[model samples]
Target: MMNDRNVVPERRFSADDSISVVETATGKRVDRRDFLRLTGMGAGALAAPALLSGGRSVAEAAEVSGTVPNLLRNGTYPVGLWVAPPPGETTVARYAEIADAGFTFVTGIDGCGGFCPPGETATAENAALLDAAAANDLDAIVYDHRISNIQNHPSEQWRDVIESILGEYQDFPAFAGFDIRDEPNASAFAQIGGINDILGQLDPGVLGYVNLFPTYASADMLGTPTYQEHLARYVSEARPDFISFDHYMLVGARPTIREDYFYNWVLVRNQALQAGLPSWVFILACEHYGYRLPTDEELLWQVNVSLAYGCKGIQYFTYWTPPLPGFHEALVTVDGQLTPLYYAAKRINNNYLQPVGKQLLPLTSESVAHFGEAQPSMGVEVFSGDEWVDSASGSAAILSRFHDPKRPNQRWLLVANREFESTANTTLTLHHTISAMFEFDTSERRYVPLEKAEPTGPATLAVHLEPGEAKLYRLHANQGD
Candidate 1:
């Protein structure tokens, strides 16, 4: 339901305009030189670099080898939402609705309007929310105002404050962890790390989560010279339970995607993979600012692309619509009615994400490749002959390869349709070493055998992908190799 009238004029930088600059998201103008300095980009390079290759280089500096730790209690791939039901509406029915939509966890349990209301403590509200989540079989990540601003208190009192805040909720079956912070600056990593350390000691079973900013953030906002440094500092200093970040790329009144979308994913995925941790992303679920409300295909596109990048968890930006200017229509309306996005999310969650994500949990990402024209400028490998795949041809797509540590010869490939609005028909030419192939059946929650190609020559399989859809295939390699 995006229209031309919603299109905001594209802000382009000009060489002549050396004195001033227009912000990319907001139209507010600021001093050009100052902006460039803050972003760590030179005047000529105001736009994203042809490639932010530093992050990739850092990832490639060592062999890609790490064990992805399981942080969730239920051992399910996390499908979480940013805002839970408000304090007044924290009922069993509402939580049940979320579970019915296929979410395994809820992140914002302090209150729906982003924080607890006046006179109501986050402890009290979160206790009630946890009870509701327990009733519905969903995990809750409690958000406490004191813990989020732990740095403001004297560093000496950090332990006492954190323990006091998390003590009661740690034992709850529904309690997953605490939302330590979101989009924190690099300067705050030490404090965040201290908090994480304390949580590890006091409640070793719980996760102390903190989500990082995307690559598009200003240098001043990131408190680092480059996005690469920001991620590096966070991992080294914060020592987080898992890596999480948000990058809402499908935007604009006319609904064009951002160039840095895949770049951001590549950086985050590499950082997480290098650290031997799981990565989570906040996918856009609402229309806010100039962002268009996503169609069903766009929603699927975001989830499928995140999976293609080896993401282990999916979080929606907002589950309950925020009652604020420029924000509109999330999965649920402000007054508690379900929006079309609710059903769209339900279909995607139940039909694709849940099953595929669980199946991918025990596997390690080996490599990812792109086929056809219109690929991103960076962080993607061109599809060529691999050990098992001879070649892949046809419509543009992404193929992510994975392998189970216990069964190294068995490979898993997830093929995602790059086009959000159209179908893609691709053909995969397999190497003779691939003895058998099977597709993961989401509905049946099992892998079903794929029809064998002619035995006389190299095997080929035709894959048809709907807009924003992906298919998972497992291949067994011949031991003789």
Candidate 2:
């Protein structure tokens, strides 16, 4: 039987759909596809093109020459944050916090509600924010308030607003793209074609960002699908290159809501997949609407869970905490302090994310197998510099993404953890004999030995994770195969 501790409550499948439970005492197994259906990843989860990056070492170049290439051509995995100003200052200390916290990008308002400094001043203020971010080696993106409800205007008015915003950022490099409409309704999506029509006329290369609500009411109620279905249909037709999603499981009194969170994200990912779009996820950073701040374990669970499922980019809903009397539970405090959430984020970024991105930057996401544990999801057959390592096994294992960054003979395998625990004892027993080194957990980010007990036998690898962690291992083809 799966350990109760590993079985997160909310996403738990019904009794009938339970998977094989090996009674620890009797050594007997029970058959449960219903359980697998509840947890089993459909075939769609397992498909992705893999390739290599432009920069490759000499040994890596000698491996496999060509394979599946990633849809996202180049760049490291980007860690992003929502931009908001401090309560009193046009200048916020969080800009520095983002850098200290080891982030790659920060997104913020150009000045919303007119309370912000006017025109050029606002642009300069935003520019200064970017300048601050750059000092820390972080990129910045601009976000305007909800466009769909701008003046609660009619469709034409909304289209004009979108066009106007796109026009403003046409020449701005510091500005990535507008978030478009935050949590837009069906009307907004249906009218999206027109909005894009306006944007195309103004700035053809700008991206249209959409953050959709988790659930929605449909005409048929019972037969009506969830909002994700609608989102998928819209994105597939719209064909936006990158899609963003917001997951707020803690919004209500759902104490055990973690399981539903991944499913909700997958719902939108399915939409992105059908649309042939790449996806990014926004994880909750603040305690919203009575929702408590996430515990360290829960936070780590969310990050590793996301990487397992295939989120190229990870975004924190709010990096600069909003003040008290409203949203008090924040990832970072108003005093520019690091909360439990902040440290959790640091541990994840420092120990896991960056190192893994360095190794896996060459691979593409090839296929997936999302079953076996509480947060069960795995992507298999990714190439690490042209070396294909077998998929992870056991209840919870590594989530893989493969890529070839235009470097003909090189590839990368982005292997991330599937569970939240700071340490994992699972081993990858490959069919081929090879020696590899991985940077694993605790004190002084050092390289550890990958012990090989035999010459021709499968390699045994054990890892120690620091909460929401990730690591990369590079192996030559002969060593890996």
Best candidate per lDDT, number?
1
Tens-digit lDDT track of model 2 for 1-481 = 2222222111111122112221222333322222222222112222212111234322232232221111133365777776344423334355666656667776654433112212211343445554565556665565443442344456657756565554444333344444455444444455555555554444444445555454422323212255655675556444455667666544444345544565665565566556655667777777644344677766666666666556667888666564323355566676556787887788777666655544443344453334225634222223222134443454345545344546433333334455554455445554353445343333454555555666566664554455445554443335223
Candidate 1: tens digits of C-alpha lDDT, residues 118-201: 323435556677888999988888766567666557899998877666555545667767777667767778888998887776
Candidate 2 deviation (Cα RMSD): 15.0
In order, candidate lDDTs are 0.74, 0.48
Weakest 10 consecutive residues of candidate 1 by summed lDDT: 45-54
For candidate 1, give the lDDT of residue 383. 82
Q: Candidate 1 at 419: error in angstroms?
A: 0.6
Give the clash count for model 2.
28
